[model samples]
Target: MASEHLHAISADWLKSLEVASSTGDSTSFVSHFLSDGWLRDLLCFSWNFRSLSGLDKIHRFLSEVVDGKPRFEHSGLRDFKLDDHTANAPSPFKLPGPQGIEGVQGAFTFTSTKPAALGRGFFRLTQDADGKWKALTLFTDMQDLIGHEESSSDQHGLYEGRKITWEEDVEAKFRAIEADPTVLIVGGGQSGLMSAARLGRLGIRALVVEKNARVGDSWRQRTTFPKYMPKGKLANFLDSYAVDQELCVWLSSSIASTPVYNASSARWTVEVQHGDRKVIIHPKHLVLATGSGSPRIPTWNGMEEFQGALYHSDFHRDAEQSRGKRVVIVGAGNASADICEDFVAHGATEVTMVQRSATCVISSTTAEKIIFKVPFPDGTPIEELDFRYNSMPKAFVLQLQVSGGTEHVKMFDKELHDSLRKVGFRLTWESSPGSGEVGLEGFVFNRQASGTMLDVGCSKLIVEGRVKIKQGQDISHFEKDGITFKDGSKLSADVIVLATGNEPIMKTARGLLGDEITDQLSPPEVLGLDSEGEFNQVYRPSGHPGLWFASGSFEFSRPSSKHLALQILARELGLA
Candidate 1:
């Protein structure tokens, strides 16, 4: 369809939505949607991330009053208009509805009066049976706090009021944060660093506490880290990012005491153990930017009787150590692929991979071209990509993926997939059951976190039989020098490396925060989709006041950092 026709359709819908929302009329508001339409709000209508499905839920969300304040009025939503940006202007889109609906999709901007904030939104409009255009999905997200716009851009070199040099100015700022941090972020990896960087731009005093001695130790310390990502190069970039962003970090530090949250002051008193000394600090908010959990090690009978070196993939840094040794890796994810390839590359005698489940395999080369090239092409500003990628609702993205995205992946990797399957590597397009996600794209969206490998060089070795495969049986037990399968087959090995992934983030949080606090968390889990099909907890509210979770890969981390910072700023300003 013509772009101008789509623009007119979007403008008309925007007008109706604005009139209904501005008047705070629930019935009129929901009249613009299909019965099963979705509304996703991020720090706009509420101080948290929420996805409401169906007209009933949307009506309740728009009409309900809490604390004697109508939720719609509390949002103070007004002035809805189509975004004028060329890239995000109204265009055609398709959804995988029962009828395979085609629709007009566009970016929009709005004003939030209650908090004095600006908001951005995206919507998909399709014709109802009566020929009236109704919304299939609408996404609203806070763009920026009015008075607290990000100020990370370069400024004049002149020291306006301070007589001291730039170094002295930054040092003083860092010291102030060290003494009285407004936000404390645990973990110094990309998630934490990005959060701190975003928070810093908003003039928030944020400190990153790293258990390691350096910024990127999380990647560097992993022995079976993927070779496609240059560890040293990324580590250097992280160190540079921390310095360039002026992020305050405490290296070789850890939480010494379980944090105590005082609701009265909305602050957390945490004890930091730096080397041998313990320092107590109080921060208004605590951000857990930690990943899912520690390396998962499955237990089998007679594990203690094994005499040879047996460890998780975390400890296998040097492939030379496996030279002339028969090694068995117990997983089929990226880590396992890397470890198996390392063993074969280093001339390990009979390196075998024990696959207990189907895996999602895609060619790394093809993935680079299909996935990263378009959205993240060279020379495009990252900030633009960040906004573009995140503006669409998760469920909408899933529809696109299921409709044709998976087919595209299958088409591109057909040859590589055929070769791997011919050699007995089982492939799957679906995520774990009940995840409600499909295909390779779904595996990533749900953060299945493992059981998928983007084949770099590992598939070639597996196809050539340099890396042997053992499949279709559960591990019965561990023998003195090897592993025994349920089929009574045994693979003799000098070393057994369990490359299984980590436990859920909630398990790790339970260990750190205890059941009392962790149990109070909403959605009941992390790293997966909630009932509303949105990521649970990460970069959003944790149900516990003054606590937040910041996680996901670099792509998610970059834009979400701003959202996290905005939430923190809103709380500090009493806008929530």
Candidate 2:
């Protein structure tokens, strides 16, 4: 298509949806999407994610006038107002060539039914070969606004109308155990919280145990902040720290033993210790959402002669300690960059980043272009973005998304890329799986490989030499107050911070779960794509029955959490 043609095609097409929806005309609404287009009604359809892949299902699902099971009140455009029309057109991320997709984004609020509540969603209307634009992918979900009651997402349960006091809520949840709960989720991070939320909605009693005192402590523990995520000033992390106090949780505790399974009961005996107290529980399911692992400290040839402070990235939070002192960071990843920036900001005398190899550094905003595809509202249901990125096959995703995304990334990062190169710094682009054995993006997302830093004002610091770069050399040995590298170079440092990554999930699983079960687990080097096509055995049965791993994108965890919950619910009822 010509540039002018592309320019002429805007988000004006959403006007039809607003027009069709305002009048409660189902036929007019179904006409908005192509005949073969799919409707992935996530949180909005029933709050329990559902997908309809053809025009027939789409028509039936949206047609309220016909009555029968086909009558869907919301019609995905429930209460859609033209006044809410928004245009985030000309997406930065391209669909690649061959099956080129030109998408224009629009967002609207709908009245989620089954107990009507305000809902919000993100839509992408792509132009077809016939020059007609239609709904290629529509993600609708509850706005999750204040006071929204349980709709179809929740099955009416014993806790349905019970108004329990705060004291009762805490005592009954923590102190008293329900002889046998259905599921036991370890770790109360996003995965665990969402999983508990799903299981709770499924009418299955579940408990989430976290070692930290608070529900969001897993997130709060990350003293360091991601460049792309909100930066923290006084708070621990300016990110989503979901409140899960209402959900069953035993805080300030950890797994006390290797959960034992019994053939007779078909249940597992698990133990947890909270300070001086120890608690044992029997449950039918176990979920490991404790997250990947701790900071991986690399072995340096240092003879321990250095009389300076040495620590891992996880423990390198307080930069005030390095005030007026020379600091050397031993990695080029995001944490390394953040620490370097922190040291500079905290009044450090000097900061140097030791890069062992080339690093892929992209502008922080590059994420919006590739990941968000546009300036999507932070409140826009995450399911929208999750489906857009993960709905495609792994192979096709590697081919189109990453490959095409890198091109646009290069365009957006031309200046930063040139600046990094002008300096002695070596930079590479993120990899597409089809391009090699394992690329950076695939490795991090698929193989749990080392990450590439998102340059948030750190690149400029490196370019200006305010934060110097030491490329391709390991610390051979430490002098009394400095370090000598394998490259025969020496540098003075008062402190050294190792921003090395962490061990894989298997290693963490072994230490926490038990050596016996860990030995039976898959190999560390292998990334599992179970029968359900999920990574790291998430939402699927691991080699061992009743054991599951729910780890990966914090944004996409809810969907996988739902998948895991449903699988457990099915087994509890002898369905799966």
Candidate 3:
């Protein structure tokens, strides 16, 4: 019946879109969503983020976007039923078989009536118990820019097709050249490098400056963060750097002064210090690829705090050096778990993890399956995966995640979840509307700091009693020998590693932007949905023109860098 009844529901929804466009009858359009429906809009056609959850929000959005508009239903929708017709569909498209879908998994698409194939959308639907289809998520964004670059010479870039030798006056030629780059990128990590790669293909003049001494050293500075990023783990990300086109990364250079953008020339003056030499560059745009974790520094009560050794995660090197020492790690997030695993292997005499609240825990094996294998199976190119996954609204991912996750919990590893509970580690499952009581991989899409832990091998250590748990205790103060908890308990330690957390990127944005500029600028959120229901600020304009933020997983940053690069190129070339 769900299949039989889908056409009518689809027709009703499409008609409602028309009504909203002409008459602004939001109530009629919003009726299609479930009572507690969520609408998360990414760069879709809005050119910004917009999230409308619940009937009120849905109605408000329709009223605003569809106000007296005409023929808003740009094209007829093509239907896809998950179970019956598309049972053999590839990776993500294969609807949650009967087991994965609570009722029915359906999908549809519509193209823009605009010329030059400018607009399009992909929407996923799920049927309610009432046998009606409602859109769970909608992804609407502009098509790719297809303009070719116009160059006077056969080659571009510094020293290109030059007949000068390294022993010759190479420096003189470099200085004599006068081409102002259109973009200046800060923090030459994954996001910055990838973005430069995209901009290069479009023949845009772009420069990336990294404070580190060498390329690929950024991950090394952060405790071998990419040590686990094997080919499978990283997918096809970093393809830009691995390929022939080498996007230049200036090493050992730091931004020296506040960057000021001049609207008169549509350029930004950036003061950079390369070693002791100051280099000034004028770029039209600035991209900040700096990671967005906010650091947490805890203050213990009592005298100046007589601790042996105390520090936050920012200073943590590795656990091998702390071997045979009594180690006490605060906080039980993913870092805490990874650090604990390292400590145990390195022969830490005692490793204790403290938790102040409940956390969402998922095994690394399960996380790999959900995050990697599901969307990025072998033989599938990353371009397809990026399009398929990025094209869907976050809500759609959350929907499929809830269904698939609940099943994994029920059938997979009850022992692991049970063992953590036995050791007093509080945990929760991602619970959604009809997908049982707990959601499986749903935490990956969470908008809050929702204490979640993706366990690698630390859970085994904790369960085996190698890593002890100290639950629900805030430190009251620290004595020369040990620290006292708020509950009056004491734990002696040779060192205290605070894995509490990090400050938002905005917290440090002031140092670079200066007080006047940073003060007037609205803070960009790293996670969680924004007022327009957006989860990312990448490639999109901040409150100020010519300023942008890029932060997220490698999966997101990979494609989003391209999106941002294209927009910046359009702006500089006056193609927008």
Candidate 4:
């Protein structure tokens, strides 16, 4: 129904009630009410006046219409308003009029049966001594009514009420420092440089501190070059038959740019040693770009007693020195494979590999497949090929007995020997084991030929074992008097080359920022070191706020340092 019509009807009813009460004429009031069909129908529906047989029905309807519902007896009128509009007219019945011209005031609530379409509304009514009760005002504001309507249409809980606490607000505030400009970065390696560059581009003033003599030292040290084999035919075979076709495609389509060593900005600082030199480089941020270096040496028996030269892989640069010498290369990884190939190329008289486990080598074809993703033309998969052609040492057996006991030996498994033989290698099993005495003794190997056996002896031996790490200790103590092990063994060696890993050194930044601040700026855990390991907390304890870290964790892939540096720069400078 139109709101205008409802208002007009309501005003008319009030006027009729006022006129009838003042005149005290039942006939006139009844005539006025009967004159309007809409008005009379609405009043009858509110009063629940129904057509029935006896006078009791009339009395019941009059009592209800006059007295109101029992719950609202104290407040006044009840059931005086129609609950809903209907197409048909209400039934006829008698309704009470004002008595002796006294005012009749009350409250009424109107509710809709279909709450989905409409809502309930409550209003207060007031009657003067001369008139009946009429709606004076609605209980709620208009906005509340509109809100109720809108709420019914919303199915998703997006409009639900929410409450916020104070602690959550504080935590959110601290996290905002990620966008702050006061971070410092150390190390020019991929992680450190990238973070600095990215921060710089973001309009943050980032400084990069590096201790290496040059940037990209890790890549440069790898000394990669085009590899070739003898007879030129093998090289040609690798270049044509074994080459991966997809390598060229990927190289051409990749969006990555070649890394340039010395950029125009001079943002990276290099070559400042710790303790011995004093250099001033203060950056708010510090990053450790240092990576792992050489393998560590372990103490062994007879090392000090050895009369011949010994070397670690880190110091073995000249393969020609092994010419005509009997060489034993240890380990089963790429480093061992490379060393074995180097010894053979330099014409070593005999080379044997000693490994701790079965070595799985990738064939050239399989390597090509990984890089190219193309199947072989003949339909043979790359993984089916024999890997012995690229095999490395699998394991080494030491002949030993208890001190002052008979010399009995424990030999390596025959499977290791057989696997080595497939790749043109010879193995020598010891018949007698050496005593477990602390003194150094010579190691022997029996050579195997095609059904013929010979003995090849070597005065020099190379011991390859697990990597060792020592912090806050003297480097010289690692091999004091050419003999040192945790257990008191008198092993002898002429020289020692530690293959222990390298760490990103931020000496320059440390010197500028002081130890306390640098420690706060650079944390080893952020750079992927173990939190509880010996090398944990490796950063110098002081740095600036403008520094940031960019490294990989053991669980995640490492980001490209060059790309990161450029991004950091762009961000700090507001160019990205």
Write out the backbone clash pairs for model 1.
none
lDDT of 2: 0.64
Candidate 1 Cα RMSD after full superposition onto the native fold (Å): 2.8
Tell me which of candidates 1 and 3 scores higher on lDDT.
1
Which is the winner by TM-score between candidate 2 and candidate 4?
Answer: 2
Q: Which ten residues in a row have the lowest lDDT in candidate 2?
A: 233-242
Measured by lDDT, the strongest candidate is 1
lDDT of 3: 0.62
- Please report the candidate that would top TM-score against the real structure: 1
- RMSD from true fold, candidate 3: 6.5
Worst 10 residues of 3 by lDDT: 75-84
State the C-alpha lDDT per candidate.
0.83, 0.64, 0.62, 0.31
Worst 10 residues of 4 by lDDT: 246-255
The reply for model 4, stretches above 4 Å from the true place, is 1-212, 223-277, 302-311, 358-360, 371-576
Q: Please, what is the TM-score per model?
A: 0.91, 0.71, 0.76, 0.32
Best first by TM-score, ranked: 1, 3, 2, 4
lDDT of 4 at 386: 13
Residue 127: error of model 1 in Å? 3.6
Off by over 4 Å in 2: 1-99, 102-170, 173-178, 224-245, 373-385, 401-404, 430-443, 447-449, 523-534
Per-model tally of clashing residue pairs: 0, 0, 11, 77
Candidate 1 lDDT by residue in tens digits, 1-576: 887888899999899889988887768888898887878888887777788878888888877785577788767789898986746688886543234568888888999987898888888888888999998888888989998988957543557786777677788999999999999999999999999999999999999999999888887776554545687778888999898888899999999877888989778889999767899999999999876577788888999999898988876788797789999999998889988888887889888998889888888787788677755667757866666667566766676666666666678789888998898988887786754335666777675657788888888888898987889358899989998888898999898998888887888777778777887887777778776767888898889998999988888898788999999998888877
